[model samples]
Target: MWVLIFWVLVINFLSAQEKFTVKKIVFIGNEKTKKEVIARELSFGVGSQIDTSDLAYSENRVYGTGLFNRVKIWAERDSGDSSIVYVWVNERWYIWPFPILGWKDRDLKKMFYGAGLIHTNFRGRNEKLIFSFALGYDPWIEAEYLNPWVLGSKNLFYSVEVFYQRVKNRSKILEEEFGSFYERHLSFALTFGKRYGLYKRFWGSIGFKEISTTGEVPYMKTLSPSGRDQMFVFGGGFRYDTRDIPIYPSRGFLVSVGYKFNRLVNCDCFFLQGGLEFQGFKKIGIGLIASRFFILNSFGREIPVYSHFYFGYNERIRGYFNDVFEGENIFGGTVEYRIPFVKQKFFKWNKAPLEEFSILRFGVDLVLFGDFGNTWFNREKVLKLRYLSGCGVGINFILPYDLILSVGFARNDTGRGQFFIDFKGGFE
Candidate 1:
């Protein structure tokens, strides 16, 4: 009996080493996504030699596209040395025509709202088209398009964006600070990018910007002919991302280094700015830990104060108000952990077309996060930099369409704390 068991184990080990040919590729639940688009992202195809490693990488590549909420790959053996690869994906809502509701600041009284049309699978090529008109504090109307694989090549992509906004000066809005006013700005930009290897991207852009102040802006006293400025700006950057899911990664690493040159075509000022960013994610037991570090520096000639870096807005640091700190050079990072106490599949539509697709999935997660950072205008002020730290706990609702709604309580170094709500989508 021992000899028979040993012989069986030897045979299985030998079989596992044999190379298997990919006989066919199949996709499930990609209703709006074109077959070619799915094929374009896969690392292996028909007649290719596939092993366990290839299967795992292929699944990750598809998930990294942010096209689906879940992806599962499996193989069905065929006659001798051949097999069929099956890919199952839960598709997110491709078309989103929804109302945009948000706050201009941390204060609930300053409400901002609007409506927009956002399409993720534009013509089934993984293209994005968005048109939005938001009103309230900083009113703006924006239209943008991003193509990840221009001309059907994974190595190239491009984006175009146009916006007209009445941006409010944070200092003025706070009332306690100086230089509060509104600026009317119109801008347009076109960028082209290239991808290298599996995780690197290089991009360049050319754009035009026009800005004019309304009301009183006390800080303009230091401006170099600052009343109204119009200029043509050009620059480029590089990014490297290996996150399995950018919005909500389970495990991976990301690095981005970029430089931008702003040449004042209508003025006498030009400056160069560079930035570095690093992010890491890892899973431990049932929870996941993630961290991000970033540094932004400016040089060349003096640029508009508006071009500088400011933290405490959106996702940068959670405990402070928007524009809490501003400077020419800024450094900061965050560490967060997400643990899911309840993870279960809800219900599945069993109707005609639904039967052909994968089932929907959902879960509830608890998040603990901390953030710290500071900004300074020059090296001399580095020692005087006022650093702020904050820690918070939050609840995350995981739903279909790669949507996560998070609400958390954060307490900063100021001994002041607030509860904040955040809406996140997978496509960014």
Candidate 2:
């Protein structure tokens, strides 16, 4: 018995120390993206000594770039203790000339429609270019261009955007007294960013905005006495993300910190804002659970109504689907348990003409969720209305282009149930 134990221990030690040199890397199904673009995300390269687990990390990094619909990686070794890494990826539909047809407040009467053209992988280097317009409840035209690797410079990135929009006022008091009114905004911005390794980055932005309203803009809504407000905006931020997938993940976390200021150069409007957000994901048996927490606060003597934080606008407490809250400071958190009903699968249509649209991946997840949030104007009001919370169950349709469509029903502290349809699958 003693002799047998010694041999077993020696075998285990030898296996634990096993390593292989990367002879080369071969990428399949990356017809458009350049080889270097894919290699930049990898943690190891040719001639590097790597263990078996490194291939999984390399695959996740490539997938997190949002460039691929599916990724599979493996290594093949020879008797010489050298191995060839094989990366298999299904590239996404990078160029889209799609029509936009959507409704607000789940009302068909309040619908918006338009068209847009975008190239998500411009020049096959992960640059993004967009041109779009919308008409109806909120009308807007926008153009944007982003290059994450500026001029091939090391880790540098930049973007420019021009936008025009007309939106209806959201103040319940103003809307009830004056009926309905509109605000117009025309703006442009230029931003620069730098990447620190694969999952961390920092950025700064400078922008200008001209804002006006129809039918005598109220003083509470405008920072300028002239009623027409022109302001300069500046912002900076840092982000660190390690999520296994950009769209959906079973593990890892994300951190973001940002600051924004208005009326920096030549305007009367004044507000400084700071925010922090963190999201984490973890596996729970056959499913996964995710959570997010965020806080946004503003400083300074004045903040325009258009800039105030709101719960029912872009973000929401699912139980209060139609209710909107306005405040100078807001904080919130959400938790969800997602169970796969139909796991992700990839398919190809050989008969299709466009290769970009021919390859497809789809899945479905049943999500159980709860959300809690509060909005307050001053320190005295903070946490005074803190009992607001909602819980719900939703079905997430995982589609191509890293998109998720969620439909759910929720109930709040008031015991009122509301139905909701949201994009982003609970996380953007």
Q: Give per-residue CA lDDT, model 2, range 144-246, as digits (tens).
A: 9998886554789999999999988876766777668788999999999998887899999999988887775456567766557887889999999887776
Local error of candidate 1 at residue 175 (angstroms): 5.7
TM per candidate: 0.81, 0.89
lDDT of each: 0.73, 0.81
Give me the runs in candidate 1 sitting further than 4 Å from their true place: 1-23, 29-32, 43-57, 60-66, 79-82, 90-97, 104-109, 172-179, 217-226, 315-323, 344-346, 349-361, 383-386, 409-420, 424-428
Over the stretch 1-428, how does candidate 1's per-residue lDDT look in tens digits?
Answer: 22233233332112354568999999887888887777766778899997876776678778768777677888899889899999988776677798988775444566789999999889878899999998886889999999988655567999999999887665322345454667678999999999875678899999998877765552362234656777777888888887766766666788888887777655677788888889887765456666788888888656466665777544357777444676778898877666776763545767636442345657788877777898777544677667888878778887655567778888887878888776641213
Return the TM-score for candidate 1, rounded to 2 decimals.
Answer: 0.81
Best candidate (score: TM-score) = 2
Best by lDDT: 2
